[model samples]
Target: MSSATHRTAEEIGRTATGPRPVPPLGEQRFAADLSHVDTELSNGLRVLAVRKATVPLVELRVWIPFAGTDVLHPATAEVLAETLLTGTARRDRIAVDTELALIGGDLGAGVDPERLILNGTTLASGLPTMLDVLGDVFTGASYADAEVARERERLIERIAVSRTQPRTIAREALQKQRYGDHPAVREVPRAEDVAVVEPEQVRALHTASVLPRGSVLVIVGDIDPETIIGDLEKALGGWASDATAARLPALPELSGGNVLLVPRSGAVQSQLRLSAQTVPRTHPRYAAVQMANLVFGGYFSSRLVENIREDKGYTYSAHSGFEFTDQNAVVNIDADTANDATAAALLETRYELGRLGMVPPTAEEVESVRQYAIGSLVTATSSQTGLAGQLTALAATGLGPEWLAEHPARLAEVTAEEVAQAALDYFAPKRFSGVVVGDAELLAPKLTALGDVTVGAPAE
Candidate 1:
């Protein structure tokens, strides 16, 4: 190397230190101006529009309370979502796709037990076309027999393939254990039912429940909120029905008792799934509990990950998160380990759960997690699509951009004492009950001794 370049490199390396202390965050709060328009149509359809001039595009989200408690509803609703936009009376499937492509737009719909979610995106100028297309589908979906038949066969094939997947198996088993005899347990419809679902059944389901009344629509883009809401009213004026939207009954609380072992014969790895009842998002203690969750297992540096993955090298990954559906909220924790290491991994996980509650977080730990929480929230809503999705979720719980803008303060205001109490009440290991899906012969021996052990097929 030249002498001059060598000397420059040496000078740069001299300043690279062993450790650099991170400066404390200044006493400045980051606030977002999330001004938006919220209105309801005469038919009870709610609309939330936010003007964001950052991009020449628009994101659309539609959420309908599509709950049905009957045994056939899950399979039928799945079929309905798959074919919702295949064709309308005014346009065929090919025509719909062609128009959307011409406008640089795309749309998709899916169903869970609690909601039917329709998500779409389009160029800013195509907002009218997007709404028109949505209106056509909402009011005039043909539910053609040929399309339904094809999608039904495809869905059956997909279900058959997914049933054997390890994650799907674990999730199904855990849901059943958590909500016995509840509709939530029927997330995946029975394969036999899917195979037999007729187009008539799907058409009937749509006619009965897929109405605009009691539904929510969130639009975010580089557009005028006032003009857009007016446009939405005009576009969806005809998309009305007398039938009220379907809604789920009050969800039963999760009952925690013993660990249920679901036998996946000859499996080399086991999935550890745990769940406990938690309060809904609107609960007064939710912010503190949310912080406590992060310190425990909600983030990479959480105690659960530090103990089970980083320290002991049991599992490669682990996570804990909340699932909110209407009035229900559930805390779900998941980790996967080798069949032989299953029991040990679970033991360490439970230990960390108990430790987080009993000992609580240190002041430094609370500050670190609180900063992480606030930062994550800011990052989540910084983009148009991100903000639209967050607002859409909040809309379901009777919240809007006001709540979105105010949640950062909520996280910041969570005290260390509140976080500790939340941990003690909610993060205790005994409050969680779940299923361990692994080889019965291998796991049953140790898991039987670990807690209550029951052996059965993946479905049982």
Candidate 2:
């Protein structure tokens, strides 16, 4: 090798002896001009329009609150969502697909305990056609017996397969442990119930719960906000309802105590799911709480992952996050570990939770996660689809675009002291209730030795 090249290589190696200081993150180069039109129609359906001329495409999201007290609501709603776009009064199944294809549009619907959502995308010029199709499905769905039967069978098969998953078992067990027999625990309905859901019942559910009165439609992309609302009025004016939108029963506050065990016979690994009651996004301390969570387990660099995965090699991945409903919110932590490492991983998890409260995060730790949080928020909403989905979900909880605009500032202003306080309040080990799902023979002793163990059937 030449002397100059060798010397240059040696200099680069010498420069790497100590850790390089990361450049400070610059101020946000662009404050999102989240200007939009938000309004309510005469029939009470709310419309939100955001204009982003980056691409000549439009994204649509519809949220209809469908909470019900009936145990069968979830099953019936699942079938309804699956078959919603299959056929309408004026268009048969094939015709519907063909028509949407002609306009370069596609749409789908899904259901959960709280809402039925319709999400779609189309060319910018096809917005009116998409809205018209949406109106057709909303007002004139046929819920044909053939389509319902097909979708229902498919849903049953999917649910049966999903039930065999460790994560699903753990989640259902945790919900039941937290909420008892509350209907809110029915995130996934019984497979048997879905099999028996008749077409007439699905149509009835569509008639009863799919109301425009309290629903929201979010449209984003290259479009004029003023012009789109008018188009929506012309398209969806026929879909009206006088009945009030259904509301879920208040979510019981999450309380932490003994751990529950769900026996998954002969399982190779355990899925540990933990949750703690938390405040809604509107809470003043939410920003601090979010940052504290990030430092605890919200990211790959979090203390929980650093201890249990990076340091100990317990599991492939672990995560902590928040789930928000209309007026309730909770923090969820999940990790899947080998049967042999389950106890050790759980012990480390508990240690990190406790340490975050008692020892608190150092300024460096807090600042690292704070930057991640701020950067994540900006990147998450920088896309049209991301912003549209976010805005629609927020609307269901009575929040709007203003909340999105102000949240970055709130996160930026959170202090290290405040994050520490939030950690102390919410990250106490005793404040988490969860379920460990694994083989009974392999995990029973280790889990029982860890804490209390309850052997019970997972909620149907």
Candidate 3:
């Protein structure tokens, strides 16, 4: 009722009743003995296994390389992965999902940067039944034309919606600009391409990528790894090559720098995206670059947040990350800001980039970032679903299932000097390529004055 009364209530609420934990200063250490990263296989299927006794749940991600990048049909492998769970020989979509619901089981598959993931989680006792059902889908799914068409239409609809999101649209635009001549530049699959895919095409794609030209299975949880591998060996041993021809798409080389701005008239906000080629996971600089990114934008407490949000209140979010694929490496920077402040925000980000390389982090900053990163790794295996995704994806990338085990040590070895070096090498503003999605006509002039800018075609 009174200003003094309101102030008193607010102050009381702000006072801590107990000693709550302060979030660690930097990326923290991950713990949980990562000693045994058991790897082996039966038949042609690769098996990566990790044991986590903390929970009764088991997570399985059975990946098939058949999402057919090998066959030159992007997204078909993903479409196939999705369709398999839609139905099986013994059940339709409704029956399949219903079966999962009744048992408190969660089962699904998806396509990520490098693999088509078939993943699920359930109690240890349910492993056998769960595996059997998954086997049926993986081995004998009915990829009905009608289903594929339905999925195709759905993706097309999603693309239309994606166009309206400035951040998503800008990222895609940046990809195109950076990879002007490379296929790795294909961000979202073209909607028109989906209309041309039939059930036969989907099957062909699956036969090549998902059917094990290069595939692996990862299991983590309560089960015995050897026993599970034995069973898988027997179940999958008979399967042979689909004999589908596969080839790698040449990765795109970075074109001389370019900036693209897409206009959205009368808009309040602008989305900024920056991308450049990056080092692979196994590169010597990988750890250092990764650590630098964490300090810059990879974490909530990084320089991006410190400047963009904490210091200026320009945006609630601004961050960066890198994703490595079999064919290429990519680093991405994203942020949203008012149209009027968009170019100014870009200028500030550029300065932060310079500082990341030129400045040495305080000891406090280094420890805090380490704490956040490592601690998150420890609990990763706690979730059966997450563990499954990690293992399967790692296997797909030619990394062993035990990859998670090495993360803490690898990250721990990264030094402040290395991080600064990585920043200096990889985060150069001159190498930066970007897309600004806003009212481009009005926004373009503001940006061109800030840096080299080219306005892209207005969205349809």
Report the lDDT of model 1 for residue 282.
Answer: 86
TM-score of each: 0.94, 0.95, 0.84
lDDT of 2 by residue, 28-79 (tens): 6322465588899878988888887788988899899889888788899999
Look at candidate 1 and give me any clashing residue pairs: none
What C-alpha root-mean-square deviation, in Å, does candidate 3 show against the real structure?
4.3
Which residue pairs in model 2 clash with each other? none
Q: What RMSD does each model have against the real structure?
A: 2.9, 2.6, 4.3
lDDT of 3 by residue, 160-211 (tens): 7876776666666676666553545455666677667788877766555556
- Give the whole-model CA lDDT for all candidates, comma-separated: 0.87, 0.86, 0.69
By TM-score, the candidates rank as 2, 1, 3
Ranking by lDDT: 1, 2, 3
User: Lowest lDDT 10-mer window, candidate 1?
Assistant: 23-32
Looking at candidate 2, what is the lDDT of residue 390? 82
After TM-score superposition, what is the CA distance of residue 451 in candidate 3 from its true location, in Å? Answer: 2.3
TM-score of 1: 0.94
lDDT comparing candidate 3 with the true structure = 0.69
Cα lDDT tens digits, model 1, 1-460, are 8776665544654546743444565554322365578999877899998887788999899999999977899999999999999999999999999999999999999999889999999999887899999989988999899999989999999988988889998988987787777887778887899988898898889889898888999998888988887788888888888888987877778767688889887899999999999987788899999999999999999999998899988899999999888878989899999987899988888898989888989898898889888788777887888888888888888888887677778988999999999999998888988999988888888888777566766543
